[model samples]
Target: MSRSIDYGNLMHRAMRGLIQEVLADVADNGLPGNHHFFITFDTTHEDARLADWLRDRYPREMTVVLQHWFDNLVVGDDGFGISLNFGDSPERLFIPYDSILTFVDPSVEFGLRFETQDQESEAEDAEASPPLRARRDEPETEAEADAAGDEDEAQDAEVVQLDKFRK
Candidate 1:
């Protein structure tokens, strides 16, 4: 199979731009009016994590919501960090740059899309970057635990709204 196209970099730039947009908003307007983000990514994708048990639980893909009551939001050349609320508790997370895959903020009807290789890749490793391109934690539920046990990493048990895409 041969085709003349740059779909690889195309998708990469698109995702990069998408992330830049969100970052731009945060940089310029400062997370306007309760407008936060929900990011999902793979834990073992190089720079993502969850609580020990949480990671041991949901090993595949994990998602976390960033809104009010979060703490220690640190953005770096690689990934980001924040403190989010989990099941009746609070947990701090450090998401790497290469782990993030999907980022969405339904409040303003905005979302960022990142293209991965397979079902395993898109398994929700949410964090951070590369040219060939890139980039979770927690299984607060059984599915999370099953996924976590599937991989060996520092995952967490953060909270994310998995029902936004449903109608």
Candidate 2:
């Protein structure tokens, strides 16, 4: 039996490690300059933990922004925990690295996306395109900024896909 290397999974691990490092730095020194994250994760993942209402609202997936007001960001080897305000109510969440589907920093026009086995199979049959870039227009109000951080930008941002590195 021939054993083939799982390059895709290897790349995923590397990318997740990168996220861990970045979050670790942010946890120690806070987000630098305009760098902030728009992280989308699978709420249904067994290791994911969010408020009951949050899970109810975002049954399958949820996106959270790490910007001005988040608190208690603790990055662990396997996951991270954070407290964010939802309608003025602070909610804590624990998100496993494997559950993350997308991580984007619109300020830098950088992003990484991980596809699930199901999504990967579906992607194999469809034409590919770069991930949507989040808009960076300055928000007019604090309320707008908070809400806007979750919105996707119109312009195309450069996303590094692991598949491109495979032979």
In terms of lDDT, the best-performing candidate is: 2
lDDT of 1 at 95: 79
lDDT of 2 by residue, 55-137 (tens): 99999998899998999999999999999999899999999999998887877867777888887766667744322222335
**True-structure RMSD for candidate 1:** 13.1
Error (Å) of candidate 2 at residue 128 is: 5.0
lDDT of 1 by residue, 70-113 (tens): 76666655667777788768888887655776676666655554
Model 2 residue pairs with clashes: 134-153, 135-153
- Alpha-carbon error at 123 in model 2, in Å? 1.9
lDDT of 2: 0.83
Model 1, residue 128: what's the lDDT?
Answer: 23
Number of colliding residue pairs in model 1? 31
Instruction: Evaluate model 1: give its TM-score.
Output: 0.58
